[model samples]
Target: MLYTNITSINHFFITGFPGLSLEHYGIVSCLLLVLFLAIVFGNMFLLVFVKCESSLHRPTYLIFCHLALTDLTFGTVTLPKIISKYWFDDSIISFYGCFAQMYFIHLIGAAHSFILMVMALDRSIAIYAPLRYTVLFTNTSASVLCVISWLLPTSWMVGVVLDALSLPYCNSNIIVQCYCDHIAITSLGCENVRDVHIVAFGLAMFSLLVPLGFIIISYFIIIVAVMRISSAQSRIKTLSTCTPQLLITFLYYMPRCFVYLANNVGFTFSVPVRIVVVMLYSLLPAAVNPIIYCFKTKAIKDSLKRKFLVRKVNIRTKT
Candidate 1:
């Protein structure tokens, strides 16, 4: 039964792809499911590889582990809801449930962004001050920074969620996209959402743009420093370490920027276009992270082989 508050909006109208056929939804469902699996399995391998390999117990890998965890959490927060919408004929999320979804989405999203910034700083220190990298990004320091990264975004999300919920919602409650995105939800509010938009935009810029700017600056310095190194091998090695981070930064930032720009400018792109953009923003990073990092690092490859091959051999012997 749909819950209704007499004074508030009784039901939300979700404005999904009106012209999208069942065949299209099926294709999208299969692709999304595959992507979700890849994200989960890939991130799982990363976490396991880090845990099993004692040699990988450096501050850099520690931060990488946290980043993978964030990606996994972020993927889990949205992908299930998306899959549900695609698989079920009638999918509806309760008000509180939608709020919770948005909260976690922002929390993990912010954590992921902050971790990327931390990773940039880590790389910069490693490149520019190799001697101090250990002392600076120590285990204690990494722990503190990781905790702060998780907490800071969570705090910001709580404030945003509270403020958003306070606004009166009229008959328009249905979210346009699969999940409860802040921008989509804000558009449904009956009350003036100018203040909400301002606050949300401020938070988004702080979390996304500011860190992105720092990453760009850090990479610029790192690149220049790499060029100064005379040895070809050293230059290649330095660039390799930063490459994975750079790829992730681009994957995350570009789509996010597009989404924010589209929302702010009130661009009336088709629902399918917006859906594709949102899916790419949400899924691609998760799908790419493990593949990029694991393939780049021989150590991770060896760990995966050992973990898988050893288990296979043991199973054969048991059989």
Candidate 2:
């Protein structure tokens, strides 16, 4: 997959959590396997519940369903390869495969940011101006936003991936990451890749901060609106609806911002520590999203109760 005359590395060795002890490998592998299953089933339950329960057909739930789908895709893209690396001792990934993995990871990262932003906006409008919320966050509008989240990244991210892919990689092919990532792959470039790094950092900031800015502003306004409610119970009830999304937003953005800033500012950390931080932010949020949704939203909880409890009762009565 060499696009130029220069000698490009054809394969890379993915170091799964650098500095990991050989004895601890089995423990880490088991944890990752459990995480993958959690992500798969948790999100699948959210998807199916949202689809089957007619009462959960509001725009907010629709957007939440899409977010669950995104999390499923995110886990699939970055988790299995690393799980295989630890469990089966398979670490070699082809150049194009590595490139493709890096591309989708960033693409999904960007899309996840926007989807969270949309979720924030949906809540902000609902709380800030209750009368206008339905008009603004219609089913059609939410669908459109979800489509844009997936499509918008496709255009700019191609250049990001191709830029790194075009660079001449030196002899070393060991990427100090669980899977192929832009920073890990670009650092192997033989020539000065400072400019490419700059472009990537800039895009990364835009993708993360722009949506984050909107989210922050939205929540600020929501706070103001919540405070104005005279009844203490009403205020609590209103803010509670938003707590799940706020928690998810924190999980996704805080570590990302901290890591990117730390790298640029020369704040040093061990390779294992950094990769753990990356995994926590990227994968942990997706795994936790379903739990948050099921527990926080009354609609989802009620739906779960109705489906499972009724089934149990029906089985007992038939027996």
Candidate 3:
């Protein structure tokens, strides 16, 4: 039954990809397994690399460290249940568990947006206020920003959690999506949710769009500053440093905004298509973030290369 009663609806069945048949389960499961492993290993490698290499303890790299940690925790909080749904055929989640998942998902997501905004500020300070950058964004300030990043998200999403909890979910227990999300869960409320929808969506957009706007403005200033540099080589060097951040920011925001629009605005898409878009935005960044940094940032690439070379020499010596 979709919903038996407020108390009775204790568990939810997660039917992933309504479009896929039983035959597609193996392929989908294998793919998700690969992505999960990559997200875990890639983010872990970046975190350890930053920690062991004291040279990367600068303000910007410290922010990168935070981003890496968020990505790791994001996947940890979200992916296992998704993987289990496919691999072990475990699709049921308890009521409290569902609310908890919803909270963490938004928590991580909101924190991520704020972290990216911080990164953009870091880049801007580096470019626009090069001399004052160090003094401005000292190790202490960076740590504070990191703390605020998590705290702000936690505070913001508390309302979302309360909103979900306040609603008596006696209408439907079936969440069409793969995981517990605010929209999907609240939709099952027995009462009319137009006000709830407005408030919930308003909070969601405020959290997402506000940071996004700051990022855009920061990048705009950074771009103008970059263009003012006279030397071609200097401009190239400055832009190269920003490429990884730019790519990751694009990966994070564009698809998310698109998904939001498709759902809210008049844009129409089939259920499976909508789910694919959502999953792409949801999963792609966690997988691509570390890869983008490894490719774009010389420090990260060089660090990994040095690690590999040292490992190779150690193996030879042992042999």
Candidate 4:
């Protein structure tokens, strides 16, 4: 699967959460199993609910549906391999598999970042200009944005994956991190990769930070508009819609920014700690997104309640 003659290492060995002992693998695997199941099923529930409930067909929920699908794909790309690594002691990944995983990992990361920005934009428009929000965030428009969100990241990562693949890998093929991340893979290059690292860092910043900046700006404008509302109740009601988004955004971005800072800025942290930080940002949001939407959005809550009540009534009638 070597696309180039430069790749001497034909495979990679991923050490899941370095510094943990043998016995700890079982515990860690069990925890990750729970997380993987939660991420998969939680996002699936969101997808099904969004699809089944016609009332939840607005731009906000549509964007969330897209987000749910992205989270599911993201977790699928990164988690199951690690779960296998810990559960079955399977750590070797083919070189092409490594490249493929790295590509999707970053691709999905970039996609979700853009999707969050889209969500923020949807919120800002809905609140700041409710009259035109419908016109602005129509289903067609949101679908187009969703397509762009998915494509842009794949396009961005094409060069990245090519660059990494072209690099000579005569050095050790051991990826110290949990998965075949760009940083973890590139660090094993046989030659000096200063320029490559520079480009990689630039791409990473563009993927994660640019959308993050947009989200921050969108929230800032949203806050100002919310404040201008004269009634306390009005302001509270308007602001409450944004609280869940802000919380989820924080949950998603803060750990990512921390990881970037720790990696590039020379902030000292143990390997296990860094891996934990990565997992926290990547998986936690996927697991919590459904809960956030269900609790925060009344429509989803009422729909779930109605379904439960109907099921109860059906059971009682049968009995």
Candidate 5:
């Protein structure tokens, strides 16, 4: 038994996402598998394309590569457990297992938020200082920024995990979500988690809300700057470059905001609604990221075409 009364439920049944039925597991599994592949392969392709294309060796794309890596890590941290839930019917994670999941989820999530902020900063510098962009965002500076982005989140997550673990879960041990989310797990505690809630909320604001605010402000400034440019063609080109990023930002930020709001306000949706929200939050960004890159950037599309054509030619030659 994982919990004694005032809790007494050891291992609660986690129904995959929020509303997914056992009868629909096969369909959900197929959809999720497709999404998983797209997220993983898409990010990998972006990373490789950036590396192999000499023309793409700039500060902007460098940050994008890092962003892709972070997205890949973030998706990997959450989706595997979701897949397992559908495949194995095993939703019961142990106490320690739950803690570990929370740690990595928060870590990658914070890293994702930080990377978005960095990307916004990169854009700000690029738009504001075209001539000095290279000098301002050198490889060394970018590398340092990336390290800080990763380390800060790592430290915060470690603290959260430690604090959560220290709390006595003397009541129930069942996590509501398919995976062990910190907010969901903390809510199950029998003891007062006021301090824990405060800390978690603080971190969420710092990691998610702050970065989101920065991105919005950065884009606002960017739009103003772009509008002031007298050349219509140049303005169009600038807007085009920013559009893909804006789409990504919208998709990433809105669902996260919903989830955080839901957690904070004690907004209780039905199981299906909750599952949809969580699934969208976890999966959509990963799925959309690659598609955005592939469609928005000609360089990636051309490279993929070349690789596919080369493979086709080789197959014909062999036959």
Candidate 6:
């Protein structure tokens, strides 16, 4: 392997798993197909269900709808090309195509983080100021926040994407990770990418930590408020309402921060372990969110039963 640069290598090969054998590619592909379908149907169903159900048109449900869209987009941006790579051995992604993928991956990822923070804020407000929650957080307000979540990340990621794009890539066009992302692309650059990564890291930290900080504070206030309740049953009941979101939030944040921190500080992970960790945190939250965040709600559960079971029984009786 002589060091001759491809000067303008138009495509980068996605190494599905650097360590995994080609024989196992299909198996991983099948699993990813399942996860992708789950993410698609799960989030899409919630969005469609929200649209069709008049009862679910409120700000609370709108927040979840925003999250559903974010998760849906996140999975779509990362999954298909990788699935194609694993299943069909089509690993080539054009320079701009990779750029688009990298851009959206970071943007959607940041949006998801901020959206989760919004959800935490929504919960906090409801728990801490029940009476004022309705007044303080309205449909208009939630909608605005949702728009901001999608837009705010756009500005932060654009510079990073542009920096990576401008840099000259060498002969090797192999991306270590499953997808084209800021870090993956920057690492391929022939330039000194330390500053770019640092800037990206700073922006990433701000996007993650600011919202995370708020969520933590919001939860703290919420916990304090919950504890003040005199009835043990009521306290348990209130905390029960929060468990699902808290669970998803933990899944969303902790692993991502760990991976980011590891990448920046030069913490070494086996390639397989690193990719698997990335995929789990990235995809699992999206896949499980519909179940944990949406369907777990009593209203949605009852609606499901009415829409399916009741309708089935009615048809049977009519027949």
Write one digit per residue (lDDT tens) for candidate 3, span 1-319.
4557545577877877886887878889899888889889999988888888988888778888888888888788777887898888898999899989999988888888889999999899989999998888898898799879889878768877897788777667788887888888888887787787888778778779998999999999999999999999999899888888999899999988876777678888887887777777887799899998887888888988998999999999999
Clashing residue pairs in candidate 6 are: none
Model 5 agreement with the true structure over 1-319: per-residue lDDT tens digits: 3456653344444556655568988777777778888889989988888898887777667777887887888778777777777877667666676678788888887887887888888777778777898889886787678778889888878888888877766676656676777878888777899999899879978998888889988888888888889999999887787766777777888877877677779987887678677877777787788788778866666777888899999999999
TM-score per candidate: 0.89, 0.94, 0.94, 0.94, 0.88, 0.94
> Ten consecutive residues with minimal summed lDDT in candidate 1?
10-19
Ranking by lDDT: 2, 6, 4, 3, 1, 5
**Segments of candidate 6 deviating more than 4 angstroms:** 1-4, 260-267
Error of 3 at 275 (Å): 1.2
Which candidate would rank higher by TM-score, 1 or 5? 1
Total colliding residue pairs, candidate 3: 0
Backbone clashes in model 6? 0
Model 2 alpha-carbon drift over 4 Å, by segment: 1-6, 261-266
In candidate 3, position 121 carries an lDDT of 90
Sliding window of 10 residues with minimal summed lDDT for model 5: 6-15
Local distance difference test values of all predictions, in order? 0.81, 0.89, 0.85, 0.87, 0.78, 0.87
The 10 consecutive residues of candidate 4 with the worst lDDT sum are 1-10
Q: Candidate 1: deviation at residue 294, Å?
A: 0.6
Instruction: Encode model 4's per-residue lDDT on 1-319: one tens digit a residue.
Output: 2223454967888887877899888999999999999999999999998899999887778888888888899889998999999999999999899999999988888888898999899889988898998888898888789889999978769999999888888868788888889989989888888887889889888888899999989988898999889999999988888877887788888887776677678887787887887788788899998899888887788889999999999999999
Q: Candidate 1 at residue 70, lDDT? A: 88
Residue-wise C-alpha lDDT for candidate 1, range 187-208, written one tens digit per residue = 8777789999999878988998
Can you write out model 2's per-residue Cα lDDT over 206-265, one digit (the tens) per residue? 999999999999999999999999999999999999888888888888888888789779
Displacement of residue 148 (Cα, Å) in model 3 is 0.4
**Mind giving the per-residue lDDT tens digits that candidate 6 earns over 132-246?**
9889999899989989999999986888888788888876788888999788888888879899888888888888899999999999999999999999999988887788788
* Whole-model alpha-carbon lDDT for candidate 1: 0.81
- Checking candidate 3 for backbone clashes, the offending pairs are none
Best by lDDT: 2
Question: Which residue pairs of candidate 5 clash?
Answer: 2-10, 4-8, 5-8, 18-275
TM-score for predicted model 2 compared with the true structure: 0.94
